[model samples]
Target chain A: DTAVSQTPKYLVTQMGNDKSIKCEQNLGHDTMYWYKQDSKKFLKIMFSYNNKELIINETVPNRFSPKSPDKAHLNLHINSLELGDSAVYFCASSQDLRNYGYTFGSGTRLTVV
Target chain B: TQLLEQSPQFLSIQEGENLTVYCNSSSVFSSLQWYRQEPGEGPVLLVTVVTGGEVKKLKRLTFQFGDARKDSSLHITAAQPGDTGLYLCAGDVTGQGGKLIFGQGTELSVKP
Candidate 1:
């Protein structure tokens, strides 16, 4: 079984359009995270939720919002997507928030035209 | 913001060659982790080092954590084409609320 999964493996939308990516983990982890990987392959943490509580909010813009309905799911909604939003978004989960070893999903490739 | 600087952003080598990738930071970390990512996939954990001057081996890969806890290295012996991927190192600082600071990443291409 896939421990972590993200929906819509590929997404293409025009500028100013809004889109959402869904992530789910069956590892029974307490913390889930959203990460953005740019064209340079630099991965940066955008948000993190531990047991449905917002814990880490990086320097991301307000246009991007993360929602965790429960401990098993975390979704990212991008408002008014721009060309800069074109990248791969990865969903990850860890048993501990302080630990660096996380199980990640395959990732959703989002391209804004 | 804490930064983890990785050297030799790109590397290409023939099969059976040995290579080393380094991850450095100015701040100390409680733990350091190494992850390998293939195309169109999220990074998978290779190993995690917590103690200073600690070394861990996973088959052909050897990971080392600096005594100061501010740097780490990954060494592969007789690398094969299966080893080709992006290697990322992440560090966890104290009181950071479980957020890991990632390196810029090293892309390794092993050609047979």
Candidate 2:
């Protein structure tokens, strides 16, 4: 069984459109995170949720929002997507990450035309 | 703000060769982790080193955390084609809860 899974492995949308990516972890971890990997393969943290509480919000664009319905699920919603928003989005979960490594899901590749 | 800098962003080597990739940062980290990501897939944790100057070995691979806890290195002995992937180094900021700052990543290509 997959410890973490994300839907819509590939997405292509026209510019100015909105899209959403869903993620869920079955590991029962208390924390979830969203990261974006740019064309240069540089990974950056966008948001971090612990027990469905917002925490560690990086200086990401306001158009990008993260919603954690619960500790097991964290979804990302993008509004007025732009070409620069096209990147691989990854979901990860961990318990007390300072003492552990995160378990990541297969990434969702977003393409904005 | 914290940042991790990875060296030798791209490395291509023969199957039997040995290589080392470095991740450096000026900020101290509570722990360091190494992850390997394949094409179109998420990264899988290879190892995590918490103590400074700690060394851990997994099969043909070895990881070392600098004494200052601001740098780390991954060394592979006799790399194989299957080892070709993107290697990422992430650090856990001392004050950032459950936050990991990642490096730019090192793309390694091992040819048989």
Candidate 3:
């Protein structure tokens, strides 16, 4: 059984197109996060939500926004997607903000042409 | 920004070789974790070291948390082809939440 899952394992779209990546956690975690992995394999935190409330938002561009419809789901929506946005986006969830390890999804690889 | 410095961004060795990957930080962390990610897949947690100077072993892998909690290392023995993947180290800075500050990552390739 998958603890966390994300939709569209691979996404390809044209530059300036709008797209979204959906994530869900079956572990009933209260905190969810989005991380972007660049071509260099550098992983950077983008956003975090605690109990459906925005908590940590890094210096990411406004074009990248994260929405948590519920405690179990966090979605990443990009407006006017650019070629630089092409990277692997990962979704993770934790029981709480209490230092517990996170459970991550398989990841969604987006390619903006 | 709290940064973790990972050395030897790329590693290539033959099977049966031994290697060590490091993650260093100027800022001390409450806890740290290591993960292994394959192509087209997300990262899978390998282990978490909380106490300073703690060491843990899993099969052919060994992990060490620096006495100052500012660095960590992963040593793999008898590297296998299955070990080929991206290794990432993430630090739990405040120890209160899942706010993970990750290193650039080390890509290891094991030749058969």
Cα RMSD for candidates in order: 0.9, 1.0, 1.4
* lDDT tens digits, residue span A18-87, model 3: 9999999999889999999888888888988999998888889999989998999999999999999999
lDDT by residue (B14-101, candidate 2, tens digit) is: 9999999999999999999999999999999999999999999999999999999999999999999999999999998876868898
lDDT of 1 by residue, A5-104 (tens): 9999999999999999999999889999999999999989999999999998998999999999999999999999999999999999999776658999
**Which runs in model 3 stand beyond 4 Å of their true positions?**
B95-97
Chain B structural similarity (TM-score) per candidate: 0.98, 0.98, 0.97
lDDT of 2 by residue, A1-113 (tens): 89999988999999999999999999989999999999998888899998999988898889998999889999999999999998999999988555379999999999999
Q: Could you estimate the TM-score for every candidate?
A: 0.98, 0.97, 0.95
Select the stronger candidate by lDDT from 1 and 3. Answer: 1
Ranking of predictions according to DockQ: 1, 2, 3
Please provide, for model 1 over B1-87, each residue's C-alpha lDDT reduced to its tens digit, 9 standing for 90 to 100: 789999879999999999999999999999999999999889999998999999999999999999999999999999999999999
The CAPRI classification for model 3 reads as: medium
**DockQ of each candidate's interface versus the true one?**
0.83, 0.80, 0.67
lDDT of each: 0.93, 0.93, 0.92
Model 2's CAPRI class is high
Q: What value does the lDDT take at residue A84 in candidate 1?
A: 93
Q: Judging by TM-score, tell me the better candidate of 1 and 3.
A: 1
Q: Spell out the clash pairs found in candidate 1.
A: A97-B98
The worst-scoring run of ten residues by lDDT in candidate 3 chain B lies at: B90-99
